[model samples]
Target: MTDSLDPVVAKFVDALNSGDRQAFYALLTDDATMSDDGNDRDLRQWTESEVFGSDGRMDVESVSDGGRSLVANYTNSRWGSMRTAWRFTVSGDRISRFETGQA
Candidate 1:
C-alpha cells in the first residue's frame, strides 16, 4: 500500500512508522496546516504530542485521490487505534496541509 502512495505522503507515513522526526517534518511545507475531526490545529504542536511524542503509526486500508487520501487504522499512545480518514493537499513535492478524523 505504501508503494502506491504519493511520494510525499509515503515519506510521511514512513517517517511515522520509523519514528523519524526529522523526516516527518521535512515532508511538510513550512506553512503546513492540519485539522483534527474538523477543527483547525496547530500543526507543529499537534505533530509533536499526537505523533512523534506518542508513537503514531498507520495501517492503510485504502487509498484515493491519486494517493493523497487514505482510510487507515491509525494508532498512537494517546488515542489507541481507530479507523481514520486522512487527506493531504500537496504543493509541488511538499504537503501543504492535511486533515484527519475518525472514519
Candidate 2:
C-alpha cells in the first residue's frame, strides 16, 4: 500500500513509476506470463501497450496477498488513466504470472 517498497508488488509499482526497466524486469520470472484485459502478452509486449510508457506513472492504492497483488491508479498515454488491479503469482523471488483488468 502507498507504493511502499516493502513487498515485491510495491517494488514493482515503484519500478513502473520510475520507469526503471531493469528493476521492472528483475521482478519477473524468466517465463513470466502477463495479460491485460483478456489477451495474453509477455512482459515486454505488455509494457509496450501504454501503461508502461517511459513517462507513465502510477499511484498504488493498496496491496494484498502479502505483496503478491495490488490495486492502483494508473496513468498512461493510451488509456489516459484509471484504477486498475494487478495480481501476481510468484514462485520464490520471481513472478510467474501477472494479470490485470478493471479494478
Candidate 3:
C-alpha cells in the first residue's frame, strides 16, 4: 500500500495480503455492506467464499477520491487475475460499504 491510500483502505489491503481474517473483519462496521459486479452481496458470506476462502489479494494500480476509490490487479485462487475497481464508504474509523467489479 502507498502513503496516498486511505488508512482504512490500506489496512484492509494489508489484511488481505497477509490473510489476516480477524484484522480484515475488524475494519468493517457491524452492518457493513458490499456489492460485486453491481449485485448486492452478503458481506460476511462473500468474504468467506470470495476473499478468505479464495485467498484473494489486490495489487492497487491507482487510487482516487482520497483513496476511497481505486483500481487494481486483483487476484484469487478461484479467479486468477483481473483488472478491478473498488470503491469504499467510511463511517467513523470503519468501512460501512464497498463496491467492487471488473474494471
Candidate 4:
C-alpha cells in the first residue's frame, strides 16, 4: 500500500484497517452518502453491515486527484475481497460523499 496520500484519506485508510468505527465516522459528515455497486446506502447501516462486520484491510494501490480518489486491493474476512475504486468528496474537513465499486 502506498504511503504518500492525503492525511485525512490516510487516516481513513487506517480507520478501516483497524475497524475503528468512531474514528471512521468522525471523518464523515453527519449525513454522508456512500454508494457501492451503484446502490445508495445508509452510511451507518452499510458500515455496520458490510464494513465493520468484516475485518478488512485496504491495500491502496494508487491514489489520484490529490488523494480524493484511489484504487485499492481490499481484503476481508467475510467476502474474500476485490479490487475497488474509492472516491471521496470532502467538504471542509469531513467527507460528504463516497462512492465505491469494482475497479
Better of 2 and 3 by TM-score: 3
Clashes of each: 0, 0, 0, 0
- Residues 1-103 of candidate 2 have per-residue lDDT tens digits of 5534336666777778888889888988888888888778766867856655536787878877776677888888777788988888877776778898779
lDDT of each: 0.92, 0.76, 0.92, 0.85
- The alpha-carbon lDDT assigned to residue 78 of candidate 1 equals 98
Best by lDDT: 1
TM-score of every candidate relative to the true structure: 0.96, 0.84, 0.96, 0.91
Encode model 1's per-residue lDDT on 1-103: one tens digit a residue. 8788898899988988899989888889999999999999999999899888898999999999999999999999999999999999999999999999999
Candidate 4 C-alpha lDDT tens digits along 1-103: 4567767788888898899999999999888999988899988887777778877789898899888889999777777889999998888888889898889
Q: In candidate 4, which residue pairs clash?
A: none
Candidate 2 local lDDT, residue 86: 83
Model 3 poorest 10 in a row by lDDT = 1-10
Which is superior by TM-score, 1 or 4? Answer: 1
Tens-place lDDT per residue, model 3, 1-103, is 4568899999988998889999999999999999999999999999888889999989999999998999999999999999999999999799999999999
Candidate structures ordered by lDDT, highest first: 1, 3, 4, 2
